[model samples]
Target chain A: MNEKKSSAGLKLCISDLSMSFGGVQALEGVSFEVEPGTIHAIIGPNGAGKTTLINCISGQFIPEGTMHFGERELTHVRAHNRIQMGIARTFQHVNVYSELSVLDNIMIGGHHRLKSNWIRQCLYWGPYGCSREEQMLQAEALELLERLEMRHLADSPAGELSYGQQKRLEVGRALLAHPKLLLLDEPMAGMAKQEKKQLSDWILDINREMNITIVMIEHDMTVVQTLSDQVVVLDFGRKIAEGPPQEVVKDKRVRKAYLGED
Target chain B: MEPNLTDKDAGTAAARPLLETRLERYGAVGLILALAVGSMLISSYHLSLLTTITIFAFSAMGLNLLSGNAGLISIAHAAFMGLGAFTAAWFAIDLGIPILIAIILAGIVSAGVGLLFGIPSLRLSGLYLILATFAAQIILYWFFEQALWLTKSPDGRFVGIPEVMGFEFGDPWHYYLLVLVFTIAGAVVYLNILRSGLGRSLEVIKERPIVSQMMGVNLQRTKLIAFTIGHFYAGVAGALYGWHLQFVATEAFDLMGSIELLVMIIIGGLGSLAGAVLGATFIVVVPELLDMAGRRLVDDMGLMAPIRMFIYGLLVVIFLIYEPHGLARTWRKLVRYFNKKLFKNKNEH
Candidate 1:
């Protein structure tokens, strides 16, 4: 099956983003540029503001900074509108709608693309009826399921899925948005070794096949080292190192921060 | 590696076949048949009882969508209903409009009111949202009492028997058919909406607003839609109530009425359409049944009111303790049992 890559992904530029909660600063003067069609990983220890940076980019947390996606300013863009602009993110925890069927969960990710009006939807008329749009949505959602190798689980309630499967489902949901830039927060966390390998392979395939840029937060050093094209290391809400994984890992500050050396 | 199935998976798997069985397919047919049999077998007085149940069921279904599906509590649902009732009455009497058109107009007016009150829900949720709806109830009640021109009920407003295309619906049997048709239509609309994208979005919003936002759901728009549709159902029910009683009174739609509607959805099953019907029947019929039983022991209607209220309170408490998911879940369980017993062989293939 052929997948269309829209816009070849867009550059994401974050300039001097600062965020604090009460007395604790989560991300301070954080600046970075994620080039189009590349896997960018943000790695840091606990409370290092890695997740906070993702939140700021996704518009969940407003910070003192300017953000640009492609040439479009996104600092004031609402969270819901960010998806329409081809930016999608998953949660630190697997946050698929637990009560919905797996198919429905994926279909929801395609909501911004469905153009059926409320009246047509209420009456099941026009595109909202048993028409092209309806069929297309179902087909697209099924294709997404097939891509994740989760076609058999489409009818199952999402919450009933195992933790590893839920994480995959979350990724599939974000992919359904056809995002130019995908932000995955701990996508491989809490997975078994086999499951982690499978997820890493899927993430690699998603990046290479779909040509979608990715910004991910992961503590799995091995996966980050193998998959990331660029790595940004954070400590105490500050960027400690920004380079390729091999060099960043060898950096003195990164090693000291990770090993907690005096 | 073998798939890891949790207890929830086991439970849902056990229940899945029941939902998919032939019996489930016939559920709608069964409901229609029951309504048909009821209309044919019951006496005029009992037909009135059925009509009242059907009317209340409409309002309860609305509340079910708002409180059950959307996870937004509304104590002002009856106020939306009351708005519909008064609007229909005003249209029918003051403007000399047709009753059918008046009923439709009433629904639209109530939807408008619902949209107005729903603004608060976009910013508030849980207890705060509930409190806001309660304020709506009080405000609407005060509006009904003070706005004499709108209500035209200084004492109590008497509405003429509704006539649609020269057919008088004053007779219980005739009104029963009307109410039954409207109720069924309302149910069809409710069920259809649930299958729609808008309905799914509302569920997403209810489950996780942040996740929903990430999934591109407009939180404010979805909430407003839920409120509008839910209250449209209420408005239709309220107009039907006016036709049933042929009278309008401010006291009929007080906070207690709102609470009663909420109770119906709670006892019937929140978020289930069948539960809405079951709850409406329970709230409406159970009280009359109790009143009949109580009348044998007590003497006056005035004295019986308090006894009825006491019984309702007791029943709600009992339901909360034992069947919190409400009668709909109980009904589903019973159906599942029968389906398993009757269709076990057929389903195994």
Candidate 2:
């Protein structure tokens, strides 16, 4: 497959990665490379194991083969520690702190960045006088909210937001982690066209402005075609096609997988 | 000079009064006023009862953090309290340490023990974690009963009168004041922790462990901290219980005591400071009130205990089935209803 390029800028590598649940093989010998500072899209029909692939990369699923981010091995890293190693992710379904304010939801995303000890937090003071670290976190979280045009909803409970807003908030939350590699699973699913356009714009802006590598699973062909630098198409837990979106979409096998024809 | 306020600023300004109700602003003042009035009106016997309620409230608040906020159910809460009581007694009597230091040391020791028991929770949750805590309750109660070095007395360990500086807190009145102060301090600390990052992390972890992990919250560490902090509060309550009664016994902190503390949090509201206090008062005073009524209705006072237990069991069942959120939620609903009615009438006028 074009010599499987492995230059210095390769941000993520998955080799011979296989996962199974009971007797069902969700993924089998999947291999891919995501370069730094680019948007890579994985598209597939139902049960193509797109979500499972992201889960394996995010450490929720234990796959058979090795996976690495940069040079660091991520195969055995705990899910929480993966975030510390600059890996962050959003779910297909909206998962947020429903009871907490929108601001607090994003501040929790910046948890690893804040260095104040638990004892200091208990005392309502930190190394930088009293509550300075907390204030800094608040400022950072507010900046993210402003960027997302959600500063007006800061004090509102996260659950009270509209579904599209919740989806945007989820992205803002993951961004607050300052991840080098962000995995987004169906981020634009269930959104109207206008909402999808706005979200696509935000995603592109995030990739360009922050120089963060993004690996996303999307069912929207238009989104994949417009945004992806590279596209990997999966069918039945196997890579059916891999290339730039324009070339991959025109492939006979990808069409067969999507249309169920020989 | 006049300020230029934007639409967003005006929106937030309009929302402020709607968000911050009278109860939200003056709730603390109301609590203090109630406590002061209660102290003045009650007899010395009733004063002791008030102190007992305050002590239970402290432990209930602690348990609320674990079971309510962190979503880790524990049935060994009183065992931690027993450990604290024994530790305080040993330090105060054997080491001749001051009572205040002894209490703090007791809390520390109980927190350590709590951390040990909390290890199982790293891998277990819900009913499985509750079972682990049940094991802790049984084992710790057995240890307190068998260990003569710690218990010291076959009947029970008798703690000396607690003293700070030159003031002896032997009198019920003085001791009531001491308990009140500690109870208020405990409530303040509980509220502070709820707003802190650590507390928020626990809530996230409890709500969605996988999501919390993605957000960079260490699930195991946060769970362990919640368990330890809960036990620390329990220890302080136990030490206070020992000082109030001048006694500590294995029988006092048995399985029943643990269940009672759990019941207190459940009935009051799970995850709320006010709920803890309300539940404590209900659990402590309800039986006494029932006994008083039984005295007038029937000549047999012996039947009162069983009747109270039956009623208590019924109340718990009713709450669990009908109002799982507990009394705090019910209170909030009532306040909201009244506020709506009052505001509706005003708007019409």
Candidate 3:
């Protein structure tokens, strides 16, 4: 495992990453670097271990690799602390606090970023209140909700919303964490065509407007081709192609691997 | 954000202030009426029994905070009660602190000790946490037994009755009113806390600890707070218990007593205050009723007195198997059924 250093605009860099689950190797010497302010997609067919690779980068697994985030080495960092260091992720299964209101759900994402102590929150008085800081977080969260067009459901419980709405809210939550690098795991897994289009546009808008680099695991080739600046194609836990989406999607190995050459 | 209000929230907000202000006034009138009726009709023995029932209700209310809302299956609650009782006794006997002050101090001390046990178990969860607290009970119980200088070595002696402003709480009726007042206050405070962030955090931790951790909820702090606060109530109950009993001992707060409290919460309902009261009432009253019937049956068939205990044990088993959610859910179902049936035409779409 070789640790790579990130330049000024580099978002995340991974080198010589290998992870094995018992007898099976999920990722074998996988390497990729995502530049800041771009959409980087990792796409693969069924059982290709695309998600497993993303999970490793997100610090869900202690893989045999070196991961660097904004000049900081993140290979040995825990999942929660990795999140704290501006690397936030959304789960594939649209995990949101169902009992909490949609706004509260997003606010929980901002909780880790909050610098106030428990005493300040408990007392809630002048000077220590840091009303400005709190308002800033709220403003940012509300703006994200408004941009996603889910602001109307802010007061409603997240559970009461439709599945598509829940996924959007989970993304909004990840965004609220103030991530420099957002790793989205199958954001368009189960959605109507219109919903998928809306989510795709939102993902692109977030990257362009917020200047947050996004590394996404997408199964939809059309979505990947449209939204991603560059695509990393993985098959059977190994990268088969890495280049611009047009070049990588048309590569013989990728075409055969994705479409069954046999 | 604008305070987005649902219909339920709007209705509750409108009704709550009125409910809050009027409840005590209405309750006072109702209580006065009930007292008049009871004093005129009921016997003195039954009145004494009612007093005991009220005190036990208070103790159960304390247990409800620990078991009901927090979802901690604590078997060391009775031990907490004993800690409170012994603390009160020692304070009154040694320092000559007034009973009210002693009770408050005892509660604080008990909460501190509960935190001491709870902190260690914060990292370890579920049955492991239970085992940790069970060890606390054993250690605390052993200390009470062996520490002859404080507890006078197991035989147990009577503590002085609390006399406030020359009014001795010698009668069961006097102590009953005092206990009921504290109990109501405790219940109200508990309810308020349940509606607050503290309560929400506990529910979050109970339902999904990993999610709460990810959301930056301090798991150790929350667990410690719950444990300490729960035992604080238990401690208060113990003071009232000791005052009511007029004695303190190892036998009063034993493992069986702790188990009985757990049974009360389990048989009542795990997560509701009403369930705790129901369970406690069932535990206290049902046995007496069984004993009365048992005496008659024994006279007729020459059965043993231990048959009542057997019956009680069997009822607990049956309750756990058939109605694990306890009588609270039964009451909820009844209410829902009535609402749907009687108010069908009135319900808005």
Interface RMSD (one decimal) of model 3: 9.1
Which DockQ value does candidate 1 get? 0.31
Q: Give the per-residue lDDT of model 1 (tens digit) for B64-122.
A: 88888888899998888988999899999999989999998999999989999898567
Residue A228, model 3: lDDT of: 86
- Per-residue lDDT tens digits of candidate 2, residues B257-315? 99999999999998888789989999999988888889899798888878887998999
Between candidates 1 and 3, the one scoring higher on DockQ is 1
Clashes of 1: 0
List model 2 lDDT by residue over A131-239, tens digit each.
5555556666776799889999998999999998898899888888878788999999999999899889888877776767889999899999988899999888888
What's the true lDDT of residue B323 in model 3?
Answer: 91
**Which candidate has the top score in TM-score?**
1
Candidate 3 chain B weakest lDDT stretch, 10 residues = B11-20
Question: If candidate 1 were superposed on the true structure by all CA atoms, what would the RMSD be?
Answer: 5.5
lDDT of each: 0.84, 0.83, 0.72
A1-262: candidate 1 lDDT, tens digit per residue: 1133445678999999899999999998999999888889999889999999998888888899899999999988988999999999888988988988998898788788777766666666444452345446666677679878899999899999988888888888888888888999999888888888888888878888778899999999998998898999999999989998989989999988964664
Query: Which candidate has the highest DockQ of all?
Result: 2
What C-alpha lDDT, on a 0 to 100 scale, does residue B138 get in candidate 2?
95
